[model samples]
Target: MYRSAIFLKISLFFILLILPGTVACYAQSYKIDSLSLLLKSHPKQDDKRAELLLLLATEGMKFDPKQGLPHADEVLSFQNAIKNKNYVASAHRTKAGIFLYLSRFPESLESYNRAITVDKILKNEVGIGAALGNIGIVYMTQGKFPEALKYFLQALKKQEELKNELYVGIMLTNAGIVYTEMGDYKEAMSHYQRALSVFKKYKHFVGQANTLGNIGIVHSKMNNLDEAIKYSKLAIQIGDSIGNTRISARENGNLSGYYSKQRQPDQALKYGSIAIQKNEKINNIKSLGFNYQNFSDAYYQKKNYALSKSYALNALKIGQEVNVTDLKRDASLGLSEVYTALNMPDSAFRYYKMYKEYGDSISNDQKKNEITRMGMQYEFDKTEAVYREKQILAEGQLKQQQLQLALNRAELQRGLQQTALQKALLENEKLVSEEKQKQLIISQNNEKLQSNKLNLLSQQQRFDQLEIRQLWLYGILAIVSLLTVLIYLLNLSRIRKLKFASTLQLREAEQNNLKLEHQYQLSESELRAIRSQMNPHFIFNVLNSIESYIMDNDKRTASRLVQKFASLSRLILENSIKSLIPADKEWKALRLYTELEAMRYNNSFTYSFEHAPEISLSTILLPPMLIQPLIENAILHGIIGQAITDAHISVTMVQSEQTLIIKVSDNGIGLNRTSNKTLVNVVKEKSIGLKSIRERIKLLNLQYPGSASFSVDEGPEQRGTIAVISLPVLGVGSGEI
Candidate 1:
């Protein structure tokens, strides 16, 4: 039990260590050398020097973390020279990681705490969450399960607050590891299941591999051998696929143990041998010891006393050297069993006594009690979190309802005011009409009185009365026109106000929609980046090919292939991480990819790319890898399997009005075969390229609606698949600055 416990503890510690980590990924040799050269050359210890020192500490640390210590110390030594608080945090984190790798727990914790303090002062919530998680890892390695779980949950809270699903998944996985150590299988499974969903959604390979491996562990602990083997195989599969030797090695070892428990010596020995090889690569001492023990169990089960005794002795020797009590106890007990089988009474008794002595210090019952208590605590914490989330959701809904009610009331009030103003205008028109009629009657009465006067005076009176009547009629007309104009103006203003309000609401809605679309685009862009990356399978195969060539002493071909693979990989990675790259860069990358495929397949086919003379590739910006999948489909599906001599793929890009029309045509077996499947289905089921391209095109069309399209059909003369992509070209600023 002690041996198994130690294996689980140490294995989980290493699992958590595989992360982007405190500073960043370790640096390449050229980058580290350049930074070191700059540091040596630069006289002033200013911002540049601070940056160089930190880079050297972080990037160079992977090569020799101990050697990187002075660089980290120098960065932290003089804050006056390096005013950047970020440098202070980075330096601390680098120092902490280096110490952690070296198993210096106390110094690692101190450095991590310093980083957390700086992050707190800076109010950097993301940094704080990351540091807390790293600290939890350090604690876990120290065998402090309770404290590790506490810190893991704390970091989970912060990551949840930030809505960073990737880190959230990492924290959940760490918590699961703690729960597993606490002997709470139920809680461990719960956390692991949650983390698995997060990792799958984000396509985080490392998280997925770690979670799968740990879940397999939980099953193994529960005595579910079949499930344990199942998940362990899965973890190994993914880990091997991704070239992650650390977790894969452990899974292989675990699988060996499972087979040993099942009494399948052959299966057990197979996995045990594999585990030994992998563990030796990384010099994983604890795993190696356990693997040796498991290997011995296999041979013991087979009744091969000589080999069994030899392996058991090896395990005992390693256990003694490492001073692992549980491993020693298990190895000694196995030796006792083996000796008893061989009729060696004295040796068996001696080993049995040793095992008893080694077992004296561990208390299983107390650990079980602690596990029960922590499981209850974990459940309570989860319930409380759900309650808080529901409460916050309710509050947000209440606020939204209040806002909507306010808007409705304002709209109703405006409607009523407009109705009242309309009524008032109508009443003013009626009053003016009545006043004009009364004035007309009064003017007629005055005209009759002037008829009784003399001829000359009547003539003068007639002239004056006619002029007064004309002026009176003109005044009445003017007043009527003014009233009409005022009513019209008021009505127009009311309409404008309504229109303005409606337009404002519509604009707000559109902006919100655009905001949501932008977020979606960003997420899709990242997914596309991941999808567009060179396949791990392709990379591994090419490397294998290169290795084969080197083994055969074909150095020139091997070198060329190596260069092509590297260049193609760099270009694809550069293009994938961005929404748009230079058209020519993408074209060249695709060409390189085609060449690598050809070289890998023993020059099975050739390819060419051409752009119109009218197009300036440097100025034209287009999304990366639009035509990549098509080319891949053509090469892999259309040509590679077929017996077609002089096989060639031609790609052409020409400016057609606003569109940059590109075509990829390959000469091989035609796409329309007897399968009765559409080209899309062939692409979707056979590979990820076409589906990813479709999604990418859809996302692009959202930003520039209907400007991007992709299609696959037979080429001219119906020879093979002809894939076409239509992209709306733009100026240079369309890509990342």
Candidate 2:
């Protein structure tokens, strides 16, 4: 929780810092002020004036992204006088950037499209490549990875054709990020390596550092912490040597993260402090956010939660100010962790919920396979555009809904005002009638009642404890008395047996006694075998899962699983040795066992049991603890990872011709999934419980020919498993079919 809080805080800090920092790095307010002064002094509707207008807009945007929107619009108006398609395209591109930074995605795309159209008409390959790259970046911000990658690849091809070395390296790096996001680590590394080579060959120190930083990120995701640290240090060294403050600051944060992950709090703090100092020097607000987040991580590792919380808050504030989803999501998550470390649950919940909302925006269903088809190729045809169009239309509809919601809130506010006025009148009436004073007196009496209730509970607890002690004493006395009575009865029986018969009669009785004792020994052995039905493997797996939950600090899930497992185990042990149990008791054990497995596997399938129409659960009998292993097999191999929505299992029992038929059926992947295994391996790995059941079936058949049978086969649709067993009905004591 503490670590997550730190990351979330840092992300937000970057967003807020970057919000006012992007254009400011290139042109301070003084440049914009001079441009504005020039514009005011020279007012002429011509080419020179249009240039002046664009210059002012571009300069003014340093302080605020929207500051140049009107100026750029005026520049576009002078296209007739300018007579240069290149200049017009440049104006559209400039306008698009402002909208992009403002998160006006639709406007940005439309402007970029206009620029592309002009570039295409004029055969401006460089402009086309640049616009395409920008478009891809916009798609990336929206989490449309496939669409982003498509454009980036196209831009890379064009840049290479044009011999634009810098853009080629940038495009390769962008593609690497898309691959990384898609979880293709090997492919991502390949792209990063190529990009790094290109940057090094061209002597682009900053680009080389950036690619190295990306490689470090992939290594981090793959859990190669040492490799991550190695690459990060190399990146930082390059950036520092070249005096690239921005790259240096970002790499320091990366180094700090690796050190924190390694549990080296001192080393992490050292790098984090360096990053923060460097960011402050450059007035890089976004970098400070990243740096502060590293501080949060270091402090959390040191167990200094107060400082961690402070840094996390700063990161979150910056993220919100910058209006970046990544920043906001991470900031909220980090903040949540910080609050959790502080033992503040409410605050933790609030930030965690915020994190979930932002995360969903990036990882929702549409971004799955559907993302792969978005804006295929560089050309925007009707068929290829359906996905992007739908996304844009949906976003627009959501915006309208938000606007309507604001209006609804205004109406609600008015209603609340009216309700408050009515309540005020009621309060005045209450004051006149002394009702308020009566209510206060009643509240005081309730408080006194609460205290009395506590006292009563304490007294009741004492009485219960005394009664429990008396019951224990009585139980011990009863056991002692019963043991004495049993000894006396045994002595009397022995005396009765002392009266022996004639020699021949005694021999005959002795033979009969030997037969009965041999039978008793066989029954005891069978019962012990029944006790062996509990699978050690299954029990061990359950224990392991419980241990994992505890290790993860998931107390709630661990406690719940442990309780269910304990109850199910108690039931199984109690019933396993019984010759016959009530049908409902066996059915309940099966249900509980299935529920435990289902919970362990995330409830990937549904289950049910069906009893014959005329069957009475109370009257019918079933062998105890005999059906659970069959269901467990179905859960593990049949449908454990199946994705179909209708996957399920059904157990049915019916009586026919004095024979009880039981069938366990499952709509699952079936046995073919294990076709690759040898037959011997399959049987051993598939269901050890079934092997035990086969032995029990053999023992049952020895009593009467064809009295019991079992078989496994394909279900109705040949897409699942069906196991059937037949047992002859018997009278409890007589044991007659």
Using lDDT as the measure, the top candidate is 1
The parts of candidate 2 lying over 4 Å away from their true place are 1-80, 95-111, 160-166, 237-245, 266-291, 317-326, 353-737
Query: What is the model-wide C-alpha lDDT for candidate 2?
Result: 0.73
Worst 10 residues of 2 by lDDT: 8-17
Quote model 1's TM-score: 0.45
In model 1, which residue pairs have backbone atoms overlapping below 3 Å? Answer: none
Error of 2 at 608 (Å): 99
Tens-digit per-residue lDDT, 644-713, candidate 2: 5887999999989889899998988786664324542543553556766776676566655688898989
CA deviation > 4 Å runs, candidate 1: 1-80, 98-107, 302-328, 339-354, 357-360, 364-737
TM-score for each predicted model, relative to the true structure: 0.45, 0.40
Candidate 1: Cα lDDT at 7: 40
